[model samples]
Target chain A: MRVSELVQRSGASLATIKYYLREGLLMPGEATSATQASYGEEHLRRLALIRALTDVVGLSVQKAAEVIQLIEGPGDDLFLTLGAAIGALPPYVESSNEQAQDYPLARTALERLGQVYDPDYPAVGQLDRALTAASAAGFPVDDDRLELYGAHVRAIAEYDIDHVPEGPAQGAIEYAVLGTALYEPVIAALRRLSHQDLAMRRFVPDSATDPAGS
Target chain B: MRVSELVQRSGASLATIKYYLREGLLMPGEATSATQASYGEEHLRRLALIRALTDVVGLSVQKAAEVIQLIEGPGDDLFLTLGAAIGALPPYVESSNEQAQDYPLARTALERLGQVYDPDYPAVGQLDRALTAASAAGFPVDDDRLELYGAHVRAIAEYDIDHVPEGPAQGAIEYAVLGTALYEPVIAALRRLSHQDLAMRRFVPDSATDPAGS
Candidate 1:
């Protein structure tokens, strides 16, 4: 297949494909002639992954490049690769002077979580950043709420892991990273759906009985 | 207090405060003089909310403005106000010509979810977008998985709504909106933390038993 077919198949624009090639986000196609190059299945897969990361996951070009490197890099360590992919996600809150005061509270919350999970894990840092953002916004999450949320998520995580097909470590790594990135919005949407349902049931009993009731 | 005091108290930059004021995301303070205006605690609170929506929830200026309108606009209806706030969140995936083929799959998935919650809700659109992205990325989520994820989130939602402070409808609306936006990252972080812990326990038995073992 040529670049044109690659573009058609991957649903990425010709310019985007070229940009990815220049950015080394996509591997160069085979040199078939002076003016023509041939893309293969690998290129198609890579292009799709790139589109998914940028278009859906909202990773920056640099972060998506890093993720591609982790996916294609010479490492069989599934856990490490998964960690890199998770790290590539945009932070919930950027570091700022305003957030400085909330770090202690964030750290304390993480310490409570540490009892169940390894506090040194990179995800712990992500958690801390989130907590700091919440506290900075004057909605400080208390220790009890954090624990309750953690326990609930642990159940979901167990189900997620259990569903991973037992196979090569590489397959597991791909599943972990892709599932984490792609299904995040799915999880969040479910949370919102649940929130809406619960809210209606508890607060708007009339509306719950007749959703059309304004 | 003046604008300077609002900035200092809210920890938002003076320029950002001015911009929000100009954008109508923040209400103008009292007209102290031709060139000076006095702000109050409400200004400070609104600034913090704007920062949290933009910085943490990642809403665009336009979306954040809509949220502010919903918050400040005349609305005694808590459910309606909360719905507007959730509706203001960035879409899980933007509509694209490339994604046209995935809509059926996304809709089917949402239909399955409708069995548990209102399928016509705005969050349902978000879930559809997410599902479309996942399917387009060649990782379509299954109905069983959606159900499993939804069950867990419903449990979490029960706790969340149960904990809502007893107060006036306006106060509950504020708590619902702010909590929804600010604590989203907290929920996501908890999910990641659980993923990391569960993965380590299931994959690296040695590390699971010996915490120091890498």
Candidate 2:
């Protein structure tokens, strides 16, 4: 398709599309002539992914590029590699039974989480970081909240894994990455919806009973 | 504190701080001299909130300014108003549901959410629009995924409401908006973590998992 058609189909303007192309965010079309180029489905999908990363989820072009590169790169273990990278961050302190001797209550709960759902170590480790960050930031997350989040994560993971069509390992990875990319917006909307749910429970007398009121 | 001090404390740079003041994202400080201005806790908090929206979440300066305006605007009912606004433009839809529905899922969720939540209509509306545009552009998403996101949102909301000292309305709004705004990084991290959890369960030998796994 022409650039104009691409713009219309993508719901992006000519200028914005040009900006993306200039930034190397959108790959160039095949140069059919001095002034003309052709695009295909790959370009469409790539552009769509770029839009989601930058425009929807609000990643910087730089950060989005890094993530996109990771997804598009030649590694079969990108998820594992990315997990390792995240786990190495200084702030990501896990609450292993051995590691959590400093915080017995937190340690006990971590063990219990292991028993309930049996998440792998990486999941637990990152949740530890998330919990730590939230707590340090003065949010009132505790063992209960962390455990709840773990359960929720497990549920979503199960659903996502179950739904994909059977395919080769690379196909599975791409399907998961590209398909799951949609969650950035989906979850953002859900967060807004949940906020609305909470606010109604708090402020509107006519709304449902407040879940947090207790 | 001087503007530089405010910048350090708020984790915003001097230039970004100036941009915020110029853009009305932050209220100006009392000018001590032509080249000097003093800031206080209010400025610190506002600057942090602005950073959360603009830098962390990647909202454009213009859009971030609008969100700041709505947040700072007068009313005991701003939370309700914000919820209403967020609901109006909701961010997700079940592809299957789009055809049968009048509004998109995000919008419908917001409207329905309004009936159950408070009435922060405008912010809710903006959030919905942003999410919808993002989803349409193909950031990974599905309805089941969004429902998990709803749970995460509620968890954060509960934590913020329960933890922040006194929990003034501005603080609540800030907590909510910043939570929503900064969600991209948070969710990205979580997505990586979740993927790691799944991969470990499937691929790793059973005796021991990587401590960095979870």
Candidate 3:
């Protein structure tokens, strides 16, 4: 369909679609005329993902662009790869690159995570790609923190797979939808709520506390 | 302890402490003499919580103040309270003027959550408080979505209780820490990794038919 039709179907404005195309976030469809191009399902899906990340999760356009590229790239072991990307784990760093070697603490953390998870060979490569994407986007996680995050990821993913209904395959798809559709708002809301609750609990007099319990 | 001592123990700079005081986020310690007010352990803890919310999570002083108020107030079924606070479910609307007929939507959602969980009264209250805390901090969740989140939270909490090393009490604490401390970064990493991995598997030319299966 034409850009106007794509906008109506996708629920995105024509200007926004143009902006996305310019930013290389949306690949244009086959050209029907000098002024018109046809879009299809792929564009719709991409638009939805973009909305989730940018509008819902609040990632910068540049960062979102990098994420889109990674998603559309070539790799195996997507689950593990996704884990790495979300955590900003580096894929491969050469030994002699001084800047890359700058944070020993972070690098060590990543290494330790690799040791603990035992996610097979493919898992390691995927983790590295995520790391690369994070670095390229300039998210401020150090290697050590990345690895710590990796361990946490392993735990949550394990918990999610083991616990969610209909086995890992179905759970995986639910997870993807949840992450894309619901994760951002849920997290943002929870964080705001917890912060307030903790702060209030700390300063207020312990009225409910029983002396006997203490 | 004087402000100087409080500063040393809390690791907060004098300027920051002053800011908190001005913002009404931190209450003044007991006054022992002119220019020599004394703070105690309670002050120290409150300061730490404030720093976590403001410095780490990046909430504004005004927003932080409102959250702190709710946390300091009466202890009730937190889940229910949170639901009320965030409008995820009907919050019982504590004030006298709030009319029994108002907020029908919120009331319904809260009732649904109460039925599904059958949590003891306190747990319901905590969940409500959590939701409220999140809402006041500007998480952008409406009452209806919060009910959906309540189900997710219930699922995760139940699953963790069943599987984790400790009993429900300890498990609850652990999940709280994990959710509060690690969920944000971890989820971000996972989303990135998942998207790239899936994209590569589905779209990358000449790659294996299923990268994950491979």
Which has the greatest TM-score?
A: 1
Error of 3 at B136 (Å): 28
Supply every candidate's count of residue pairs whose N, Cα or C atoms clash at under 3 angstroms.
0, 43, 42
| Order by lDDT, highest first | 1, 2, 3
DockQ of each: 0.50, 0.19, 0.05
Count of clashes in candidate 2 = 43
Evaluate all candidate structures by whole-model CA lDDT and list the values in order.
0.72, 0.55, 0.47
TM-score of chain A of each: 0.79, 0.66, 0.49
* Candidate closest to the true structure, highest DockQ: 1
Global lDDT of model 2: 0.55
Answer with 1 or 3, whichever has the higher TM-score: 1
List ranges where model 1 is wrong by over 4 Å: A74-79, A92-103, A114-120, A200-214, B74-80, B92-103, B113-120, B203-214
- Please, what are the lDDT tens digits per residue for candidate 2 over residues B1-214? 9987887787678888888788788898888999888888888766655544443344557766766676676257756546533432223223354442334454555443333532224343434545555455544344545555565556755554454345577766655654554433444445555554565576564623543313
Local accuracy of candidate 3 as per-residue lDDT tens digits, B1-214:
8899988998789998988888778888788987778898878767765654443333356655655554455244444444323331112223344342243333344455443322222223334433333333223345555555444444433332333234544333333332333234333444334344334434463443323222
**B15 Cα displacement, candidate 3 (Å):** 4.6
What pairs collide in candidate 1? none
Query: lDDT tens string, model 2, A66-108?
Result: 5565555627675554543343322234345665424433334
> For every candidate, what share of the true interface contacts is present?
0.54, 0.20, 0.02
The fnat score for candidate 1 comes to: 0.54
Worst 10 residues of 3 chain B by lDDT: B84-93
Q: Each prediction's interface RMSD? A: 3.1, 6.5, 11.8
